[model samples]
Target: KWRGYGVATADFGRADVTWSTQFIGKATDFNADPGDLGYRTPNVFYHNVQFAYDLFEKTRLMVGIDNLFDRKPPFIQSWTDANTDTMTYDLLGRRYYASFRHLF
Candidate 1:
């Protein structure tokens, strides 16, 4: 399957607008991840956005949006000896965070 892509915004003397939305089948739940739950794979839609600016010398301000669509990891399988599921969990949801860096 295939989709489409386009630009968001572009302006000088100000922050640039950049974004991307993709729906991909991404699954990762094995024995080495954060949680060890048998084998669970789920379809995921990812999104990303970034707003950057050069504040000062070696100082940069970056505001990024990850998982903007609130995409979450697939539900992990339950391995219980009681022949029933006791605990189950999934990945985090859409997160909005900011970050700053100094390349000094």
Candidate 2:
């Protein structure tokens, strides 16, 4: 697994921007060669971006999206059980969310 993050704050406004990325490697799952589906797994990378602005001295609004690239998980045969192994794949593609926070 790998991860990174970056943040930017402007002196003129109460605005903040941030970016982050992460990588998940394929699993080492193994079975007897005879039961192996002959499928290979590949590493996947996910990226996210976020923006926040202060609406008031004590209130801030933030918005962001995860899995910006919308990468799909590798496909595996049914014999392996699950179509795509959740152990090594992220089925959820690009998600967006917003939130507001108040500080005392």
lDDT (0-100) at residue 52 of candidate 1?
Answer: 76
Cα-based lDDT at residue 47, candidate 1: 72
Candidate 2 residue pairs in backbone clash: none
lDDT of 1 by residue, 28-95 (tens): 54443554553545454567787877687677777878767776545445434432222322245566
Question: Taking the candidates one at a time, how many backbone clashes does each contain?
Answer: 1, 0
Residue-by-residue lDDT tens digits, candidate 2, 6-36: 4444443888877776667664335324346
What is the TM-score of candidate 1? 0.47
Taken over the whole model, the C-alpha lDDT of each candidate is 0.56, 0.71
After superposition on all CA atoms, what RMSD does each candidate show versus the true structure?
Answer: 8.7, 4.0
All candidates: TM-score: 0.47, 0.69
Residue 55 in model 1: lDDT: 80
